[model samples]
Target: MPRVSFVHPKGESQEVEAAEGSTAMRAALLGGISGITADCGGEASCATCHVYVAEPWIERVGAPGPDEDDMLDFAECERRPSSRLSCQIKITDELDGLVLTLPESQ
Candidate 1:
């Protein structure tokens, strides 16, 4: 399992063990981490799982697919270079200790 750290805009941080192959959104939601809504249940249809991958972990997480990219346009927060939907990020050994920052609004 990999550990995913979520840092909220208000400075709260939650660290959870993410099972390999599980989406970051699923891990966060199951662990009770605030800020990840995952309204579409990882279907990539909703942008409520928006998050910003920390600089060091971005490359490890890779880029989003077309569907995720399109859904991001409707995220509750402003999009940025590091913006990504948590549902699109799968847990892997390479992503151990990955850090994600929650947007101010979602």
Candidate 2:
């Protein structure tokens, strides 16, 4: 399992272990990480699972695909260079200890 740390805007955080091949959104939802609403489940249709890949983890996580990028434009919070839809981030051995920051809103 890869452990992911979810940090909120105010600096609070929660860590959860995600099953390999699963998405960060699924893991966060299952772990009860509040900031992720996942309104469209893991289909990538909703920007509700928005998160920022902590600077150090950006390269490892990479940029979003075209489809995901389009949806990100609808995120409730302002988007940044590091913004990504959690549903688009797949958990893997290489992603262990990845850190994601949650925006103030979905």
Model 2 agreement with the true structure over 1-106: per-residue lDDT tens digits: 8999999899998999999999999999999999899999889998999999999999999999999999999888999999999999999999999999999898
* Residue 97 C-alpha lDDT in model 2: 99
Could you tell me every candidate's TM-score relative to the true structure?
A: 0.96, 0.98
Error of 1 at 50 (Å): 0.3
Question: Candidate 1 on 1-104: residue-level lDDT in tens?
Answer: 89999998988889999999998999999899987888889899989899999999888898888888898888879998889999999898989999999999
| Candidate 1, poorest ten consecutive residues by summed lDDT | 33-42
Task: Tell how far residue 83 is off in model 1, in angstroms.
Answer: 0.7
Clash number for each model: 0, 0
